[model samples]
Target chain A: MKADQTLDCIGLYCPIPIVKIATKIKDLKTGEILEVVGDDKGIKLDVPAWCQATGHELLGIEEQGGEIKVYVKKAPN
Target chain B: MAKKEKLTIAVLSGDLERALAAFMLAVTGASMDMEVSMFFTFWGLNIVKKNEGTMKSKGLMKKMLNMMNRGGSKRLKLSRFNMLGLGTWMMKDLMKQANMPSIDEYIAMAKDMGVELIACTTTCGVMGISPEKDSFRSEVGSLAGAAYFLSEARKSGVTLFI
Candidate 1:
């Protein structure tokens, strides 16, 4: 597997962070992983819900030094 | 089979909160690479009107109503648009300074982003507004009825009535 692509979405509000991440993931090739970084408390649920709704795969989620990181893989349809 | 997922938002309220929320959702949906559509009907069409003024509040009760007008509600009874208030003017200026696009800008952005804007024909006819009138964009789809809007909503992965 290649190194995951990272998307920093900190400081943005609801929908904006999700929107930015979605836009970034669309340009990536299938099987490529995306690392989404954000601090929105809502994103902890919002991102996963969005990924599930849009058919994207959520690989993992972790917290490091107070920042939240979401791992997503572009799933093939 | 994996089906393409899209979102369609039906804006049926003309409240400021509803309009802003719908615009935000549309911008977000487009950014998400989802095909999004906004159906403007009833008072909701006011947001798209070129001549419409900003929402305003006068008394304490009215101010409370103004703050509550963010999201479209099926039966929300709020104060009318404030045509002569510093608050309304301030709100517009604040939105501009915040880098938030105006309703008109959002409509144009939606077009550029391939988001569909559908006007309700029934409402337009009742209000005596014509699509050919000045300031209305030709890119707006035909005035559709509730049935048509609902049909499109059924195909969308997420549908919002704002």
Candidate 2:
């Protein structure tokens, strides 16, 4: 799937990847998509929880090699 | 526009690790556009102390505790196996290896994200630490009672004690 932008959070740990996602999402327009790349242990739960809590849309999550990529669509206010 | 959900975290411990965890949550909460507030009480107050003039509770025991916990967030004792401060150093090194933010960096991130940092008024009194006299980091706002913060916590979507 395509995204408006990509955030590479590889090598980062819990809270950092999630925090970056939260910060990055603000720059996107409503309904725009952000692709997050990370492999943190918390990402499996944290990314989905973050989207659910913040009302963002989780498009999909795919694993490539050793990295996990999360696609999130910004939600309208 | 709809109202944003908020979180209130009550940091009740002075342990460096728990305080680090608390700040992580605060930053994450605020980053998602949620109003995040942190209430620091008892040992937790050490996290907000400035570089100098740490307050100690009266009596030798409390004084010794203060001596052990002198450096604020910069020099916090680990909750377990501190090893004469070596454990904290090892943990810092581990965090660096993982590309995680340091405790000081986490505090900075929470502040930058607009996390409301409030020191507990009663704890301040119990420790004989006058908020007006003893210095604290600029991140900390005016002191408040538990009742006030508890009220805020009650209205929050989630509240954590750590």
The docking category that best describes candidate 1 is: acceptable
**What does candidate 2's lDDT look like per residue over B1-162, in tens digits?**
668777999988989889988998899888677899999888898788876665645677657656665647886879898999899889888889889898788888888888888988878755545655245788786678879797988889989999
RMSD of each: 8.0, 2.5
Q: After superposition, how far is residue B139 of candidate 1 from its true place, in Å?
A: 5.5
Off by over 4 Å in 2: B53-71
- lDDT (C-alpha) at residue B38 in model 2: 94
DockQ for the candidate 2 complex? 0.74
Give iRMSD, candidate 1: 3.3
**Candidate achieving the largest TM-score:** 2
Instruction: Tell me each candidate's TM-score.
Output: 0.70, 0.90
**lDDT per residue as tens, model 1, B16-124:** 6567678788877876567888898767766655543323434565345434432222222234554554455566677676555665666666677788888887766
Candidate 2: residue pairs that collide: none
